[model samples]
Every structure is written in C-alpha cells, then in structure tokens.
Target: MAQPRRRATPTKRDLLRADLRRSTPEELSHALQMLLDQSRLSRDERLHALASALVVEALAPYWVGDRTPNQAHDALCADDEELARVIEALAPMLLGHIEVREEARDAVATIEAMLGF
Candidate 1:
C-alpha cells in the first residue's frame, strides 16, 4: 500500500506568510493599528503581530526568498540600508507601545536589539 507523504510542519515565517496572504489590506491595517495602540492582545500577541506585519507586509515584497523574521531583520540590518532606515523610523512607535510584560520582554528585547533600538 502506498502511504501519503507527511507534510513538514510550517515554520513561523510560513505561518506569517499564510496569514498575510489571507488578510485583506484593511484587515492588515487594523491589526497593525491594534498592535500599535492599546489593545486587548497580550504583549506576546502584539509582538507576534508586529513581526508578522513587518516581515510579511513591509519586507516580503523586496525579499527574494523565504526567511525567518530574525533572518529578515539581520538581512535588513546588514544588506538593506533603505529598509533598515524604514524600520528605524518605525522604532519610536513600537518602543512607545511596548509593555513590560515578563512573558514578552525577552522577545521584545531581542527584536529591539536586532533593529538596533
């Protein structure tokens, strides 16, 4: 009997790309706003949304291949000066919205360090 091949588990980047493909512009905008301002979402949720939006919406168009969020961040910092400037401009808003939650603090710090914030 022939067995079906099992699909590999989706990575976080895959999930984010899927979500971005599924979302409308309005929906993505609303989610971005929710992440930017105070919302019911936990800090972790907000951070996830931020990474998803930034990587999928902002960077993916310019990016050629699949990349994890961290990889994308590193690429932008190392190779893409224009995109790095864009992220720098956005840093203040993200920094302002940042909440000091124990669960998300390390993730936030990692992202901030990557962005040179």
Candidate 2:
C-alpha cells in the first residue's frame, strides 16, 4: 500500500514563491527585475552571508549536532586549525560587505574603548 506524501513546511519565502508561480511567467520576470532594482543592497548582503555560512558548514560536515547554528553560542569557542583557515579565507571576502564587523581590536585602549564591541 502507498501512503500519500505530506506537504513540506513552507519557508519564509514560500508565499513569494507561490505568488510568483501564479503570476504569468513573463509578468514574474518583470516583477523580479523591479524587486532587484529596489532591494539590491539587501540582496547582495544576504547572498554574501549565505555563501559564507554555507562554505563553513560544507567544510565541517562531521560537526553536526542538535542546535540551530550559533544558537548555543559555544561552538565558537572550540579550538581547531582547519576552522582557522576557514575563517581566514572568509575574512577578506566578507570585509567589503561588513566593514564594521571587520574592524580590528586594540588591547591597549581604556576599558570602554577596548570594549568597542
């Protein structure tokens, strides 16, 4: 006997996907161009962050556990060399998009200045 398959849970963008599908393909193409023009900067950042996160995940497949990534906030404390290389490679690529995040720290500064976080 075959059981009917259940529908998958919808992602946040699922409504947009559904709307696009209902639209004429030609209309959808036009809408895409308009949306891109309006939100190019946000789109660029999202793509870059997604790419960096995916690269890190792909590099450490065996590190799978039961947390929604950075959820535990402790994974960042682990010591590993390959992890170092992963971060180093991603730093320059991400600098332009995240200049504030890429700033260097000064250990000799006053407490408040040193805590520029």
Candidate 3:
C-alpha cells in the first residue's frame, strides 16, 4: 500500500509573513491600514500589539533592499494616506527597538527620510 502524503499547514505567523511578502506596495499599504483601523476598535492589548508588529514586518521589505526605497516613495506618491499614517506611527517604534538587525538599517533609514524625520 502507498503511504498517504500529509499536507503541511502553515502557522499563522508564516501565513501572515508570506502574504506581506507577496503584496504589492499598494496592497501592502491597504492591509496595514486595515490592521491599524481594526486595532483601534479592539480592546485586546495583545491583538493590538500583534497588529502593530505585523505592520512593522510588512514594512520591512521596503527597508530590506528587496524593494527599493524609490519604489516605496513612488507608492507614497499615489496618495495612500493610511499608509503614510501607519508608517508615521510605526517608524519610531521600529527605530527605538534595540534588536533590529544590521541589514535592515538602510531600509529603516529610507523610511525615516520618506517620513521627513
């Protein structure tokens, strides 16, 4: 008898990360806006924190060199106010963290410049 093949299930974090990675700049911005808007109505502190963290992760690609800073800037030019607002809210938190990886510094710097901070 042939053995049955088991399908692997992705964990929530893995799924979220993949979705963020696949999103275009506009789609990613919209997703972050939704998460931020949802976080406001939810009273769960953990949920809010998770949403914030996910937003940060979603923004990481812009800073990670896989996506150029100019691409992010161009997306910003498309008038994504929610994306701008989310970036303004999250940039400080990301910059203040002590554990940010060295590779992410350039991306972070790009974000800072974009935000005029």
lDDT of the candidates, in the order given: 0.64, 0.56, 0.60
Model number with the top lDDT: 1
lDDT of 1: 0.64
lDDT of 1 by residue, 55-110 (tens): 45566644657776667667777877887777767765565555445548888889
Better of 1 and 2 by TM-score: 1
Off by over 4 Å in 1: 1-56, 61-66, 77-79, 100-117
lDDT of model 3 at residue 58?
52
Query: All predictions: root-mean-square deviation over Cα?
Result: 16.5, 15.2, 16.4
| TM-score of each predicted structure versus truth | 0.28, 0.27, 0.29
Clashing pairs in 1: none
lDDT at position 46, candidate 2: 59
Separate clash counts for every candidate = 0, 0, 1
2-117: candidate 3 lDDT, tens digit per residue: 99964344344544664776789887765655554544454444444665676655555455656676566455535565776676676566555424545488789999999999
The TM-score-based order of candidates, best leading, equals 3, 1, 2
Minimal lDDT window, size 10, model 3: 6-15
